[model samples]
Target: MKIALCVKQVPDTSDIKWTENNTMQREGVESIINPYDIYAIEAALKFKKNYNAEVTVFTMGPLQAVDMLKNIIALGIDRGVVISDRKFAGADTYATGITLSAAIKKELPDFDIILCGQFAIDGDTGQTGPCIANLLNIPQLTFIKDISEYNENSITASRFLDDGIELVKVKCPALLCMLKSDFEPSRALINGIIKAQNSDIKILTFEDLGLNPEDVGLKGSPTYVSKAFRPDIKHSGEKHYCLENNSGAQIIYDKMKEIGVFNG
Candidate 1:
């Protein structure tokens, strides 16, 4: 079985700085692999160990994102691919999915599964994984909590749902978005770290992915952020105290009354 793990580089939550354009300042901002992606990688690593399959970590971002790939390689993945170029900047979920789909189609064949984190920390949109699956026209399951029961031709797992949980089954060559905390990520072995430091990853440019200028980046994005601002913090609210033996409901009612909820 062959597995592909899609990971992303995000600004370290601890140290965040903004650019003049209000976008995250990547230059010098400490970065780490997306936490959710770690879970996906760990899942892939488990499969690789049990089945002796090839594990490839794939990422797309600025040149600095190569660091993230190095971090993954240290975990003993077979190889890594860095899809980086200036033209890929400002790509929204739609364009990102399109580009990744194209890359997967062009670079890989005979892969049995694709895995990704639930969402990128920086974006928090939780859209890219499903978007990639949609672009590939493959079956997908998100928020997967387990995969040990998975098989070569199909998989059975539980997904997160608003009401509670949902059990899902999907055929192979499918995509999954996993919650990072679902499994504990492994640390890099000493030997693996040394190998990773010297591993040669295939660095792909925009052209390598067969993407045109019009098909990626901000121009390719359908949505745009018109404005962004930090909302003023407001911390004033009405508090009610119990009168005599009044119940909690009565206190809430009195507070609402004071706020004129009873008034027409």
Candidate 2:
């Protein structure tokens, strides 16, 4: 099976930088792989181990992202493809998805499955994966907690929903957006690290992918951030301290209920 993994190099959330226009400043900021992509990597490695599947990772960023690709490549993936170009800068989720879809069409046309994180930390819109599926015209299952099995004709997965878990069997050539779950990420193997050093990272430019500047980056983006600011830290007006097994807690709850707090 051919598994295509879409990953991203995001600025370390703790030390993020923003531009005057509200877009993230990724050029010089210290960056790391999106934390949620760890789940996607873990899932891809599982497929690789169980089914002997060939795994390839795809990402879009500046030219420096080559280093990020190599870093993940050391995690036992086969190869990496980076979509890098100045024209791709400031791309919103929609344009980003378009670019990635085009890259996948040109690079991994025969891929049987595509895996992505539920959302990227930087964007947090959770729109790119579904957008890619829409553009590619493939079935997509989001909020996926686990992938039990992948057979020739279909793949079994469980979606993590708020109310309950939903299990479904999907046909091949589909996309799965992985949700955060309790699992350790796979470590870098020695042989994998060696392979990464020797592997040649493939680069696809906007023109190389036959994408127009007007259709990508800030230009192609249909939406823009009008304003950006941190919300004020507002705390609740009342504070009550209750000792263990104290009736005061119940009294406070009942009084709040009397006041129709949350209609409880």
Candidate 3:
């Protein structure tokens, strides 16, 4: 079986830079793999261990992301591909989904399954995975927390919902957006490090992916960030303490009435 692991390089939130147009400037920022994507990698690795599946990690980022791909390859993925291009700059989640889907469709047409993190920390929109599935015209399950069974044709897994969890079975050629799991990611050993350094990570550009510049980047993005700024700290909220439960309840009631939470 062949598994496609879709991953991403996200900027460190603590140290962020923005472009003049309110978009993130990622070229020179320090980056790390999305934490949720670690679960996706673990899933692909599990498939490899149990079924001898071939796992390829795919990511979209700037040229520097090549090192990030190497990092993933060090985690036992069979292959790695970095989709990078200057033309792909300033792409929103929608455009990014298009570029990644096009790359996967053309390269891994026979892939049995695609795995991705539920969302990237940088954007946190949680839309890219579903977007890719829609563009590829395949079934997608988001917030998948566990895979109970896997075979050549289908998989049974647990999906997390706001209300509760649901079990689902999906056929091959499906996409799964995975949530973080309890599985601890394995550390890279010396062999993995050596292999990673020697491995040939393939690079795909916009032209290589047969994409038009206008179809990607800001041009294809239907959404725009008009402004981004931290809300001013008007004042710190006050905290109240009551010695008794009844007193606390009474205080809360009075405050609610004062704030118009209670009518009349």
Candidate 4:
């Protein structure tokens, strides 16, 4: 099995700060690989170890994101491919999916399986994986909790749902959006780290991928953020002292319900 694992680097949500110009102030902010992506990597590694498969990782981000890919390589996977370009900045899910599909086509021509996280923590949209599948014109299973069965020709997986789960069988040359429980990410091995440090990680630019400037990044994005602002704080402590099991409390609750607070 030749698998392609898509990973991404995201900003630390906890330390996200905005600049005076209303954009994210990335300086001094910590960044890490997307947590969900680790599950995808772990799944690919499992296939590599158990089935003697080949796993190649691909990441799309700035040049600095190479650090994350190097760390991924330290998990005993195969080589990593990075796609970074200034023209790819400010891409929404649609643009990102298109760009990644182009890169995947250019890089992994004979790949059989494509794996990605359910969603990125920074974006939280859960759209990129499916969009990539759409761009590739391949069948995809999203929110997959486990790969129940897989071989060179087909794959059976369990898709996570709100109340239950759905079983899906997809043909080869397919894409999957893996959930966190797909597998546990491995720790970096010393030998693997050394090999990763010595490996020549391939870097692809925008033109290298044969992308049109208008087909990516902010210019390619149809959805635009007109304005960004923080939600206003409306809750204020207004606790009233009352006896336990008091009818007054029930009355207040009923009044709040009448005003639609409870319903909302």
Candidate 5:
């Protein structure tokens, strides 16, 4: 089976900063694989182990993104493809989906399964994966919590919903947007790391993918950030003390009543 996993290099959330243009300040900040993408990688690895599948990971970012690709390759992926070009900068979910769909069509024409995270940490829009599926005109299952069965022909997965889980069976050549669940990510093996270090990464630019300059990046994005600001949050703390007796219980009850937390 040929499986393709889409991943992203996202700014570390712990120390995220915004630029004057209302964009993420990536300079000098740490970058890591989108946490949700790790679960997608894990799912692909599971498929490889169970069915002897070949997995390839794809990302759209700058040259620095090669580092993120190498890390995923170290997790036993067979190859890495980086879609890097200045024209791809400031791409929104729609533009990103178009760019990725073009690349996938060119690179993995016969791919059996495509997997991606339910959403990227930086955007949290959860739109790209489904958008890609729509652009590619393929069946897609989003918010997948578990993949129960798979073969060369089809896949059966457990999808998470607001109320309950739904089991879905889809034909091959489908896309799955995965969510982290009980499965733990595996560490890179020594051999896998060495292999990743030595392997050549494939880089694709906008022109190479036959994309028009106007069809990518900010120009292609229908939405734009009008304003950005952090809301002021206020915090208050209170402490109360009473003797270790019925008075303490009474005091607690009184406080709860005062706060409208208790009526009895």
Candidate 6:
């Protein structure tokens, strides 16, 4: 089976920084694989283990993102592809999806399944996977908590919903937006690390993908941020004590009245 996992390199949430334009400041921050994408990786690895599948991981980022790709390869992915180009910078979810779809078609046209995280922590939009599916005109199963069965032709998985879980069976060549599962990503081994270090990461550019510059990056993004700022939150410590008696009830009533909790 040929499986493609769409991954992302994101800033560590604990040390997030924003640019003057309200975008993420990624230059000096420590970048790691998107935490949720780890689950997608784990799912792909599970397939490789159980079914002898070949997994290729893809990410769209700058040249610096190669390090993250190497780390993913060290996690036992068969290959890694980084779609890096200056035109891909500042791409919104729409442009990102378009670019990724084009890359996937150009590079791995025969892939059986595509997996991605439910959302990236930085944007928290959860739109890329579905958007890619739309662009590719393929079936999309989202909020997937578990993939129960798979084969060369179809996949059966349990999807998460607000109320309950639903069992879904979809044909092959589908995209899945995965949620974190009970299975954690394994640590890279020494041999795997060495292999990754020696592996040649395929770098794809805009020209290679045949994407027009006007249709990518900030230029293609329809949404714009007007302003970004951290809201000021303040806490006040005020306590009230009530005795266990009628007077206590009266005290509570009075406090409620004082705070306008009671109109009368």
lDDT of 5 by residue, 1-264 (tens): 898899999888988787776577768889889989999999999999999999889999999889888888888999999999999999999999989999999899889999999988888999999999999999999999899998658999999999999999999899999997776688999999999999889999987899888888899888888887766576685656555454777777888999899687
The lowest-lDDT stretch of 10 consecutive residues in candidate 3 is 237-246
Model 4 / residue 128 / CA error / Å? 0.9
- Which is superior by TM-score, 3 or 4? 4
Model 4 residue 226 CA deviation (Å) reads 1.0
Off by over 4 Å in 3: 14-29, 236-264
- Give TM per candidate: 0.85, 0.86, 0.85, 0.88, 0.89, 0.87
Steric clash pairs (candidate 2): none
- Tens digit of lDDT per residue, candidate 1, span 187-247? 9999989988899887888888877789888878888888986556888965666576667
Cα RMSD of predicted structure 2: 3.9
What tens digits encode model 2's per-residue C-alpha lDDT throughout 61-146? 98888988888889988899999998999999999999999999999999889999998887899999999999999999999989
Question: lDDT winner among the candidates?
Answer: 5
Tell me the spans in candidate 4 whose CA falls farther than 4 Å from its real position. Answer: 18-23, 182-184, 240-264
Instruction: Order the candidate numbers by TM-score, best to worst.
Output: 5, 4, 6, 2, 3, 1
Clashes of 4: 0
Between candidates 5 and 6, the one scoring higher on TM-score is 5
Q: What lDDT score goes with residue 32 in model 5? A: 88
Better candidate by lDDT, 2 or 5: 5
6 Cα displacement, candidate 1 (Å): 0.9
Report the C-alpha displacement of residue 64, candidate 1, in angstroms.
Answer: 1.7
Candidate 2's TM-score = 0.86
Task: Please give the CA lDDT of all the candidate structures.
Answer: 0.83, 0.89, 0.89, 0.87, 0.90, 0.89
